[model samples]
Target: MVLAVKGTEQEELQSRDRAPQSATVSPTTGFFFTSPYRSLSTQGCFAKITQPAADGDNLQGAFQQGVQQAFAQARQAGVTNPVLCGAIPFDTRQPSALFIPQQTQWFERQAFMASVKPTLAALPTIVRQSELPKQTQFMQMVADAVQVTGGEQLEKVVLSRLLDIETSKQIDPHALMMRIIAQNPQGFHFHVPLNEGALVGASPELLLRMCGSQFHSNPLAGSARREADPLQDRQAGERLLVSSKDRHEHQIVTAGMRQVLHGRCRHLHIPAVPELLSTPTLWHLSTPIDGEVADRAENALSLACLLHPTPALCGTPMLAARELIAQLEPFERGLFGGIVGWCDAEGNGEWVVTIRCGTVKANQVRLFAGAGIVPDSSPQAEWHETGTKLSTMLRAFGLQG
Candidate 1:
């Protein structure tokens, strides 16, 4: 939904490859564009601070300032409805610090649901692929980069191409988002898991969303999906728990989180053990961390920003992994591995790591998946790992591949 602001000039801010529609807003105000890039976004102007982290470095203050600046700048230049989103990066590994207020029945007092009739153009049927280099070329470049960075010798990098197909159906983006929320009221949902390919349910985690002072976030560290056969499902959970490679990957993610949250929060609870968590297709060794903010210096989204590019989504020894990723992969990640969520005036919101997802367009849909590559990583296995992840998104779009 395009917003019309009462301003004259428009700022040509950032890149155009973003998820469609999803917005964040305060209860008193209407909806606003939460991020400059929505789904397939990566090139927006991101501010990175040098840090052991600071109290004042947060999303709430930045957003409040951003709103003021946007409107003020608009008035000066004569622009209207300046679409924007603010992100904060915190180095914590716990459940999101954002709190989302309970949606009481009174808030739903009216039959506010309305049909979203879209006059979308006829979507084209097309198959597209990212230009990835050969496995050997990719690995050699990664190895060389790791050596230069004074890091451990790099392992293999997992890569997968999505065979995405588009249908002419115009689904209600917002209603689908709300449906996820209503179904999983007790957990994080509405993550905008794109409807294309094998991925169906967008999320069981709320990356970020807000209503007044409340913020909500659920960062999933582990995953396991229930299999049709009960015994097999149990075996998969066990596999995720005991596999050294998987455990090693999860540890990198969890430890990075601990480093980020150290002094920023209170009543912080870190679990010493990990449990098995499952989705429909796979199982993950999962650990859920929760804590409260002591400084009120940062809002949940800002904190989430710090945790962006975690080892789970990215790879371990972040610098090393990122560098290696740049060398090994042929296409830009865009927003495939970025953050997705919503925020409001007070800076309260949630954002989720963009993973297990895809990008939808008129001509084609691109599915993305990656896995941690370690010494023991097998190229074939890593290939299958990504394939499993891609299936979920395909299911959502009513497509099978």
Candidate 2:
């Protein structure tokens, strides 16, 4: 792969024939970022920033500084709209990484067309699959929410489980990403290379998208698994729409987002009701919020920082719910519930919640999924919801629960 700066000669970033050994690449080295909606994808690195320990309160400021530095470096190479992409940990205090690609390439429809040609023989076979938070433990965690908090202090908390898939050989990152994109072309698809592995997924939720002073956010909360039978699938979606528990959960996320955007936006419009959105594996309660920001300085990343870890991902009464998540979840949500996307120096970008995602290291792929727990949430139901969610990525790997 050759990466050429706008005004410079093409430079080889990697050999086109070389294949990525793992799906998740180490962010410390170099990486690429792309979205299904955009025509352009970035590759290689011009400048990179690593926040091994980021302060929760100052994450926005940190991102701003990193972006400025990256743009400065990109300007030196005479590139405009250079893309910065990476993942932030679920806990903002943990380390995060972002990269500014040295070169950008435009694709007809998909950014990974050439890389997807790897034969099925090169694809890894799943040797074993294990759930991180076993069914019993996950159910107990859901029980703990009501038992410990009495359902008041913590209204909702999203608890996630990991699915560890051990493969016969290292999975090819590009091929895996292509499969995901092909399966769900309308979703926000991303691939970020880390040092040892990579992060890849197709997300249906948009955390935030900024184009100049206008912005949009589509938050999805309530979910139901898609059924094989057409009649069953329609019934499942209709059931989700009217279920009081699901409606309440969806309301919490919409209300929380409105509160966050109140001051930043000059005018905001949020529908009174949520519409149903469908992905290959699940149906979601989705609300599209649109607004115009008065603060020209606010930019996309800053807005993302302010609204991230939404009730959709974290839960209501933010801090309290975060504490509960820490007490319950056994794994560090390294980039699973975080944000993924790109932004330019002008603050124009789109970021989506890192759900329906997996981390690949060596021959092991760990997929993550979560369910929103409320006062009336059923333990068994939540467990099944997560399984339904994991099916999206699992299917991409040619595996089924």
Candidate 3:
């Protein structure tokens, strides 16, 4: 434990472990976050973290060690089987907004949802609306990405768009989360309270999950808007299934995923063809990959950091895709494409891709969604895809695209 350090050395590590700085939800003291499988609700702060999380493959400052430091401090504070939960930024180099909760409870999916009845309550009226890059600019960014991908230097890049709305009153996050879950009941729903606002979403992609010796990930790419009519919807999915360009975009993600998993896992399984997954607004090509960890010490966060910014989230040839995303994107992603979940002392947790999500503050909400761009990608189609993606949250607010 870090307790062995003496004098100024101990003070330094302790300073790095201070509680996360956060503002309260309008009325609640803590936060509530969830995955498709379970929910984590925290009442107050315990020993929190100040260190930047998971410094790449460098185990010295990565998840396993970070957890040991955090949980060890939790034990000293008299907490039992404590868990750290919060949002990890898209960039690993940034400081992590994680904290050990003084009071933490885990709930089964059905039980938690059963208690949260869907609400018909009207959210605050949106008095103003704005887009980050504007439609034309976003399309041009996609076109540029397409041209870059058409070359050998880059294969694919995922770009995102933002829609900011100012409401007549502060939004009730719990009610909004309920509406979101009611629409996409099977997705990963989360609401993590932050210093300014709350990071909330219902993500369909599982970044990583670990239970005992095994781990699993479901990476999604290539999508088509879901039509209201049954026949057209099926047709849309079928077309996406047969699209050479979409398949190529999807394979780039799977290939990057396999490479990362192969280095830390054994008995890997990734199906050759991706299956279609349907949400209320779109259909996605998804691959369910599973395997046993080669290293017993691999916690959920460690593995997640290693495989993070997957081509599905970032783009292929990871670094180049990121550089381009930074250049073309009008704003910083913050936690948009990162992860939101929790891990306990046992090193098991679920981290879902932060998609179909938004940042909810007093009287406002910022929604985020991204589309993967490939050589044959159409900027207009990409625009529509992202709009459909954003609708998952917009509909929750009783607003339509």
The CA lDDT of each predicted structure is 0.44, 0.76, 0.80
For 1-401, candidate 2 gives per-residue lDDT tens digits of 11223323324332212323333332123444455444345556665566532432243565566566657656655555566667777776666667666655544344254345533333687889899889999999988875654556777888899999999987777677767777776777777777668888888999888999999999999999888999999999999999999999999999999998887789899999999999988899999999999788777778887888899999888899898898899988888898888777777888889998988888989999999988888899989999988988988888674
Alpha-carbon RMSD, each predicted model: 9.8, 5.6, 5.3
Q: How many clashes in each structure? A: 65, 11, 0
Question: How well does candidate 1 match the true structure in TM-score terms?
Answer: 0.62
Q: After best superposition, candidate 2 residue 347: deviation in angstroms?
A: 1.1
User: For residue 300, what is the lDDT in candidate 2?
Assistant: 75
lDDT of 3: 0.80
lDDT of 2: 0.76
Superposed by TM-score, candidate 1 places the C-alpha of residue 81 at a distance from the truth, in angstroms, of 16
Task: Encode model 3's per-residue lDDT on 6-116: one tens digit a residue.
Answer: 122232222212433232222134556666666666666665564665463445665457668878776665565767778888776676667776766555676666666
By lDDT, the best candidate is 3
What is the lDDT, from 0 to 100, of the residue 184 in candidate 2? 74
Residues 1-401 of candidate 1 have per-residue lDDT tens digits of 11223312234332122222233221112111222122221122212111222222354454334444443443344222222332222222211212111110111201222222322332222343342444454455434433443434433233334444544454444433344223323322223322231121244333444333343334444444457888887887887788776676566667777787666766566576677755656676766677676665455445656566666666656666666666557666655665555443245555666565555443345666666565655555555566677666554443332
Cα deviation at 83, candidate 3, in Å, is 0.8
Give candidate 2's root-mean-square deviation (CA, Å).
5.6
Cα distance off (Å), candidate 2, residue 228: 1.7
